[model samples]
Target chain A: MATTTVSPPAPGAAVPGRRRRTPLARREARWAWLFLAPWIVGFLAFQAGPMIASAWLSLTEYDVINPPEYTGLDNYRELMADPQVARSLGNTVYYTALHVPLVMLISLGLALLLKRVGRLQGFFRTVFYLPVMTPAVAVGILFLLLLNTQDGLINRGLALVGIDGPSWTTDPDWVMPGIVLMSLWSLGSTVIIYLAALQNVPRDLYEAASIDGAGAWARFRHVTLPMISGALFFTLVVNTIASLQMFTEVYTMYFGNRQTQTSFNSDAATFYVIHLFQEAFQFLHMGYASAMAWLLFLIIMGITLVQVKLSKRFVYYEGEDQ
Target chain B: MLFVAALVGAAVIFMLPFVWLISASLRPREYVFAPGFLPVPFAPENYAEAWRAVPLVTWLLNSLVVGVAAAAAVTLSSAWVAFGFAYFRFPGRNLLFGLVLATMMLPFAVTMIPTYLIWSELRLTDTQVPLWAGNLFGSAFYIFLLRQFLLSLPREYFEAARMDGASYPQLFWKLAFPLIRPALLVAFVFEFKASWTDLLKPLIYLRDEHLYTLPRGLKVVLDRFGYGGEQQWEVVLAGSVISTVPMIILFFLAQRHFIEGIATGGRKG
Candidate 1:
């Protein structure tokens, strides 16, 4: 109110008059800048400078022990030709392929069950979602103990059923699968997301399908699936991105046991990010690591763009002008 | 119905690791190898041994400090930034907000090297500053989350404050903040979980043993004791159980707010 009285615009003043506008505009800008100072400084010191430096560092062959030398395109070319990169990429793709679908299925099941339950839904939902709160590192260790070869509880349980469980981590064939199984521990968050989406689904659609003599599976297919496809697609995009960056489980499982010298069998579990980490810090190949980071950026960007493009065909929006 | 049975079955299977963790933690040294769901003669002392094995109390204190500090920093700064974007008109506002969100796409791998370089140059590698420094900038996720909440609030509140001669800071403190306390609390829980569970930053930054957080300390315990002998397994399991306890407790305490936060945050997406 004081500001309104102190600063009044003349009715006859020219629109965009420099005298009247500049000071007020400047005042607004100052306030905005004051509000934005922290984020901007952080972005510059932590984000922009680092991003540009990493981009430049990608072209130079710099180990920490020696000065960087310009080796234009060599890192890129080597990355193109490297079998290890190819192997890691292949392993990552395989891991994502297996893991994402399983995650979607399990989370969808949880969400649907919670939605259908008439009583104590809150209790069940909370119980099922506890894994999201568990520390991921601890979960990795717990899985390691459970999947260990000799005294593992998983093997013991299987033995009682007249089946023998393979060494989950050391065996090359089982390594990625073990990672996938371990990954299910954190499905709580995804289930929570799906549950939220399911809650938003219109009740009438299910009732309509029921009136048409639809069975549970038929109703789910005709009503539930179509209704939640937007959430489904959103989850897929986020999940794909998250799964592509899966490093913690592998690092903990493999590196945590590095003293044992238990060969990961085929490097099948060495994901792309893990390999990039090795090159950057462990091997001190900053330039090569930069190139690897850029390549991953491009790969993730490409996948995300493809998903965005493909979303139009599958994702349904309710009551939109379209 | 078969569906109920199937869901129950799946829930039990899903909860196996948690059950095993508690079981293994409670089992006596002799009964560890004896395969069963129940532990005979519960060794509650394992929790004590686990406590003494590492400076877990110190780790807990460190974790609480980092978590609370990060949560406070993120909520305050993000709410301030969100208020500006939601309430005020300014030049380059949209561009700046978009830039803020765009940075989210830049993964840590791209920034880790340069960040480490800057921190090492500043001689902050051995302190908790590196962990908390990232929070000062306002993470993209929290910023976006708060912005959505702030945007949905009635604009009349800000306009009324302006009519009452309130400056931006006063409006933020007295009016906008109280209304958005729920959102701020939700962001607190998120930021807390992120800081608490974070392993990589602390592993990279803190060099001294006493400075180690829970996850990093768990790694040390796992390496030192999880192997070499059968008795060590009990200690490690007990340690793992100890490390996981606070999170379980925190989840129970904050579960309602957390779920609501997730639901609300998810709705906009």
Candidate 2:
């Protein structure tokens, strides 16, 4: 690891006259601002600008065609009472809660399995991550057929085992679960991430634990889990954020076609972002939708804060003792 | 022995859905759901038929153009900014860089409605501009990626070049860009994938029939071909195959770079 100690401005790495004096320091600062002009400008316009506007827009009633009227927290107040907002947020929370655990387990398991394989590791790793590389829309459409209750391969496989497969996309109760399954199908990238983290875990730690009469589960618990907690935290945070705003799969499977908007199971797959999308774009309820976005934003921020606090308690960084 | 068997078995089962997808695409429309999971009575005509269902060729070309443009924008601009973050120190530099990292956690949905309004106000909505314009600005993830890669390079090279009177811009272009090509490629590929797979942005912004990307066109195909449950499912699957195969090919072509990016992203800050 290169010592990231700021290193005293790199000793005039980009220009001569190596000193930390005012004029030289000002020159470096000017150069940095010049070099970073594009990102800084774009960040202001695209990122910070949208954030501010979204906040203000949340307080007003505006359709695209008409000017915004000050609604004075009506949007947020309505959000408190709206059943759909509750449903969408509930669905999203259920998904994030379920998907994060499933992804962590599956990716960690696959990473562990891959670590043991020798010659065929590359082949198996490629196969596992292939779905992750595939577009989500394509994956969703394919799963729609694969999880079809009647002729789908999943149902067929279940039938051969003497079990009946429930409706995946149709059953309201099973809809989000089915989407969760679809989302987890592309666990390859997360698996690869875990695999990298696993590689960094010192082999001697495992050996030491084994020699100390720790069984396989005990070694994994004490040595492996502690070592990989940082990676686990990383994946958890990322997956939580993505799952909170999951739209592609849900939109692709249930509401891909506008003709199906009036279908029975429309609300079944109504995720937070998808609801926000329909409200903002389809109905042009930009202010209401902006309010929903902010509400979802607050929920995500809260969850992330809680996770960080909890991770601080449990995550064992290898070098923190130093 | 048990572990090996389980791993291989798991791989096969994990791949079953995709294998089934390809088989379903190749099977004759009538036999697409015929219990057997093989591409029997193969009909490649489904691809041709799906192609004709919409202006798929145009959409494909549009997707390619948008993807390449967005990838270039994301790569170059991100590398430029990362050079600044990696090499220089200024007042509030840490704070500004922190802001860049902070943006990564923001859901695009939070900014989507307002950005759309901004674009609409500029009369740029209902076009493909909304899909790729923001990407021209460096994204936080790619900026962080390139910055990490840049910091990993020995600083002495820039110092040597500076002794020869190379300007910061020249150092960035001539030295830093070439040195960090792999990370740049990673950002390029990521942006390309983002633009390629994007649905919501295109769905909201691209209302014209001819402006659809492959993903959006696949939806159009679904509407036209897979309207009722009884309609042809093979064609939709065929469209999906078309949408997916390029990414698979790209993955195979640059597997090392792609894997390295994923691994490095996990390892670094």
Candidate 3:
């Protein structure tokens, strides 16, 4: 050991003899920062640089072949009037509004049921998480098969039970709902998070609730809910953000004849990200798409802020002792 | 009795889609609309047919390359960066780590145009560079997970390593890296899955057929072969089956550590 760690300074050493920063500590800090160099560079180039560029790009009309021209918020103004933007908004909100809550309920319920199961805890966990591991594109393809109007497995099965199934993806009204169901199928990780949180809740609280003659639902509402509020809030925010960015699944699900479809279908299920993608890539409306991107960012931030504020009242954080 | 009902009910809901998918994949071409869940007169050659139809080998290889490379980059760089955050107490450490979390919320759309411009400017588009290039730097989520894992580690090793004159780099590569292998595995599997399944990146960057990854290849296959009278789904389902089965096996194998990673991530404020 070189002991090159010793610094030149004892000048700050007082009657209490507070130590100065050692060479080794200084070297460690330097090394730490060095280790983070790749990330620092990446964050600047990929994240911060693009963010600033996007704000600027949103205000202009830039075509990839030509240089960006200063248009003074024309893209923003256009976005305000764009019918496509409106359709994208309607579609996104439709998906998120149902998808988030549905996923939450399913995930939480699965966690609760799994907790009570005498055996097969691991089996249930594995089964639930399997879909999460499946690729979104594959799920989209499977849904295209399963959600077929007549011959598909879903309708075939439904007929056995004396029920009819809708043309899920093709039907304007059912499209978003179909996508939501597909996304909901992968709530495995969310359930795992909730299950972990559920396990941490004090058993005594449940016991106390039961002793007070509260039934299962009553105990769940009062005791269980508050205990895992943090996890609930976490899932809510994450699910909302993800659902708002819905694309690959919807895009692939309807990848059939894209030239004729999304454009003519009233944009019913063309999600915000998909719409933005088509604008930027397909139509070369880079500046307009960038504007939409900024708006999406604002919307996500606003939703998160609202969730934070809302959860402040509902989410329970216990003291360190408990 | 009610608990049993709930358990079975939840299990059915969770398992049905997969069961249907697996069943459909194995069903004979003509019997695709067969009445039951089981694939009667099972067609075992669906896998072989799908393997031959598309360049499943090429796409799988591409995806594997991207997945393995991205995972390697992610595991190492994220662990390195997270090591910095977790092990060292420095000025602005908390603020910087907060920046890491904050970056996660910035959607890809916000950054896509410029980043694409950057890649295109460097002539990297229509190639695979754009997909895995940025991954080499690491992601905020994995960084946070690795940092969380590192925070729990005992500092006793640092003293002994210091006595042995080991520098921070040596300590990181030699000591901390092995100890945090579990967290690294979690990050690796995550990045691998992400890279393999990622559609948006490949969609934006790779336009060449040969360059297409599995997801993109699968999409192309669906668009082309998806039309159908017969033999269509056998191929498509086979492709889907091929795409799905590996990840499922991986999930089962690394099940515990994988859940631990997710649980660890959610546990923090």
Candidate 4:
């Protein structure tokens, strides 16, 4: 169905406006509100209220112990001047740029392979998805072992091919790539998503295209790609947003316990959320961190909006009037 | 034949890290970095050592408690809310549902600090309460998921129940709840996984080592054994495997639901 999207549909679809209210409808409305009470309370306490608080906190200099002092626009201005902010944002963007496309491509490829597999489809899917089940902490630790410069499995594998591998965790240049490699292990979920979408593509379309003398690649490009473009666009946006907020894995591996490490290039791995986390928790720069959070919120919103705008051109919904 | 070969090859690559993890966990401290895939000098004592080196059992128990609490809370509440949106054709329902969907996109970073502050203000920071308590309000994603499932159910069933003079609560607890068990289970399992693998919340709120969940405890284990103290990589790998086993078991047990739920997610996307 065209409605098979993970992203929420546009807000006002098929909504009846200003209908004459029956007594039964009013009763149902009251009951609906009652049923929604818990969420409303939660939304107020956890989300909406906190968002307002965070916005105000961004304009103050509170460090939990002291009373918040007013400093309008100061934190925002500091964010503009902060070099670490720039570095962290750049690192996050770089990582996202590297990660999103690579993951989409690899997962799509795996999904295609899985689709071609006969009886062993489920078996292969399970094998691929096992890593996705692993906790971020475990994944991070496991990757540290795998990416070790000297005796790690990955480097050893490279050595088997007569190619020297860089010290993934230690070297500045290779650190982000190492994290990206680690992230790629968990692309199974994406693969599963693509597989589901791929399976949903009508066989008749492919048959028709083939009947028109279209080759395999041409059939795929014409029939399969457009049919699954909604899913692709969805994953692209979701993965990009998730990549921007890459914290737990990077933190666990590189920046979590820096006091223990003598020499690891953590700078390359210092993503934006990591920097915000450090400020809020480590340095207790509550005001500054709040500003960073708002900035990230704005960036994510802007990007998602741009994606939705762009998807109008690329994503084909079935049965939509062209 | 070539396609099968290609699938097998890719599957091997995908499975290699796990194979190596299992092998490394079973190896001696000195042999952890060994090149061979087989644990020739088999050292199952690493599990014992890892168990002793960290409060692995306690962390697992803590993880179970938090995961269950979070999962149960989110599942029940989200289902309740979803039922409201699904069964009730009320004014402003679409608007409210739209708002719920919008919250799914709001990054957790915006609320992280203030939410922490809210807990600390209530003097509930450092307790396990902060880990799962907020879930009592129902999460946006689960609400949407359950709502979709609820929407797919035939309205005739609910109407039939209502015509039998069933109250709203009866309509929910007796009719909708039982009918939506599959969706509820999906939401529960998904949330359980999320809570089990969550590191950030525990890292922020938890101070006492005894209170740490598996992921947070694993982080401590990594710091102690893997990086700092003794640099015993085997012990860390063993702990990692220990922490991962529950999830792997859950996956196998709920394989159908897990696959179906994910596919549903893909379909919805």
At residue A223, give the lDDT of candidate 3. 91
Docking class of 2: medium
Candidate 2, what DockQ?
A: 0.68
Q: CAPRI verdict on model 4?
A: medium
Of the two candidates 1 and 3, the one with more favorable DockQ, higher being better, is: 3
| Model 1 Cα shift for residue A17 (angstroms) | 7.7
In TM-score terms, candidate 1 sits at 0.93
TM (chain A), candidate 1 = 0.88
In order, the Cα lDDT scores of the candidates are: 0.79, 0.85, 0.83, 0.89
Stretches of candidate 3 exceeding 4 Å from the true structure:
A1-26, A211-213, A259-266, A320-322, B228-231
In angstroms, the error of model 1 at A140 is 0.9
TM-score of chain B of each: 0.94, 0.96, 0.93, 0.97
lDDT of 1 by residue, B1-269 (tens): 77777778777877877888888778877676567777666888888888887798888788899889898998898888877766666557788888998897787888887787788889888998888867877777777777777777766666666767787789788988888888888889888988888887876788898888888887777767765223376777887777788888888888877897777655545
- Give me the overall lDDT of model 3: 0.83
Q: Distance from true position, residue A236, model 1, in Å? A: 0.6
Q: What is the TM-score of each candidate against the true structure?
A: 0.93, 0.96, 0.93, 0.95
Evaluating just chain A, the predictions reach TM-scores of 0.88, 0.93, 0.89, 0.92
Which lDDT tens digits does candidate 2 get at residues B37-87? 778998999889887766878988999998998889888888989898888
By TM-score, how accurate is candidate 4? 0.95
Error of 3 at B82 (Å): 1.2
Tens-digit lDDT track of model 4 for A189-264:
8999999999999899988998899999998898999999989998999999999999998899877776644565
Of all native A–B interface contacts, model 1 reproduces a fraction of 0.54
Clashing pairs in 2: none
